[model samples]
Target: MLIFFKERLALLSVPKTGSTAYFKSLRDRADIVVSGPPDLKHAPVRRFDRFFQNIFLKMYDTELEVMAVVREPLDWLGSWYRYRSRPELLGHEKATHDLSFDAFVQGYLRTPRPAFADVGSQSEFFRTRSNGRGATHVFRYDNQQAILDFLQDRLDTEINLTRENVSPKRPMDIAPQTERRFRKIHAAEFDLYDRAR
Candidate 1:
């Protein structure tokens, strides 16, 4: 999808989703490289319309299979905390300053501020079909291997992926507080995410 817009293929990165490592290894393989060794703070995926158009349609639309990897909401939040909190890794002055796992979860609940794409829910992003080419696939981070195989078939490349964005923070099984916050903040996304779960 991003490739259609910039005329180059790029890995639409999402925060704390092991995308950093995934992109690092795949950077050279990708035709239009958005992920690089230098490490960009606000990469292209950080933009709102990451997948602006699909060249096939010659319209400003996202392409099908413009999928994203979604983690268990709570686990996702925990991993995000580890990534952003590490100022050195993320190269942010205060990436995690004054930010708590609970607070961030609350924020996501309040507004599922997707680092990439416009809407929240994974289904929303995928369901949103565009005459111009929109995302059609969504891979769960828990099932990355299958997603990678799918991508391999699509891109016609042998991808040997390694490295992950694992955080030391213990996973919180029941995020009641987080759930409550999301219920209020990301009402629609919460509904969708729950339904999917």
Candidate 2:
């Protein structure tokens, strides 16, 4: 997560959404950057509301507008699948080296997901708190220019990004029936991505 205090903006690091690259690009300019201990680094909307919002309001008299990027549901899952397939994770319980994309996604749909498919839901991550606070600005992963434009204009500074933490390139094909089931069961993810600018 990157916090630009002066701009009253907090960028939530949604997993597999190129947030690492944004952290790399903006860390120097951000007043506070949480880039370690994955849990904190990937702090979601509710976590921010619970842990940091009050501090900002009391100390700085600022109500930070949260921003985040969300990727298409299937593409986001594919990234996770490919990432865990890396050779270094071959012996890890969470590795996807032995699973096909379809199997991985099917596992993800299980009530108690298998370790390899246990990635949390993006919709859940950005869900609004009881107070109706959640990400105020959202960008689609495919729309890099729009994200950049918004950041540059908001921060009043030049922004440059370099790809970081990219997952391996692989052809990820899910059976049509499985894809249908996934979309039906995880419709919230699609809805959230569609609403992103």
Candidate 3:
């Protein structure tokens, strides 16, 4: 996460939506940077509200508006599948080396998801709190230029970002039935992504 004190904005690092590169590019320009420990780096809306918001409110006398990128739900899952398919993870139980995309989705559908398919949900990540804190701005993962443009205009500087932490290239296709099931199971995710600018 990168917090721009002057702008009163917090750029949330949503997993699989490619926030790492943004974090890297904005680190120096940000007032506060949180990039260590995967759990903290990928802090979701709830976590941010509990921790960062209170601190910012006390110190800055303003709540930083949160922003995040969300990818299409299926594409997001495919990234996770491809990521886990990397050679280094071949023997690991969390790897998707031996599973088809359909199987991965099936695992996600399970009450107790198999490790490989327990990719986090984007909708839940940016879900609004009862206290009215939530992502004030959201961009689609595919809409990279728009995100960069937003950052550039907000920070008053050109933003440069190289792709970082890309999932491996693969024939990542899902079965139609699996896609339908996934969409049904995670309808809110699709809804949220559709709402993203």
Best by lDDT: 2
34-127 per-residue lDDT for model 2 (tens digits): 9879899999899998888879888877799999999999999999999998889989999998889999999999989989999999999998
lDDT for every model? 0.49, 0.92, 0.88
Worst 10 residues of 2 by lDDT: 162-171
Residue clash pairs of candidate 3: none
Q: What is the lDDT of residue 123 in candidate 1?
A: 32
What C-alpha lDDT does candidate 1 achieve relative to the native structure? 0.49
- In model 3, what is the error at residue 107, expressed in angstroms? 0.9
Candidate 2 to truth, TM: 0.97
Clashing pairs in 1: 53-61, 62-133, 62-134, 63-133, 63-134, 64-136, 65-136, 109-182, 109-186, 110-185
Of 2 and 3, which scores higher on lDDT?
A: 2
> What TM-score goes with each of the models?
0.59, 0.97, 0.96
For the record, the alpha-carbon RMSD of candidate 2 to the native fold, in angstroms, is: 0.9
lDDT tens digits, residues 74-130, model 1? 565566555555546454543544556665565554443534211234434334433
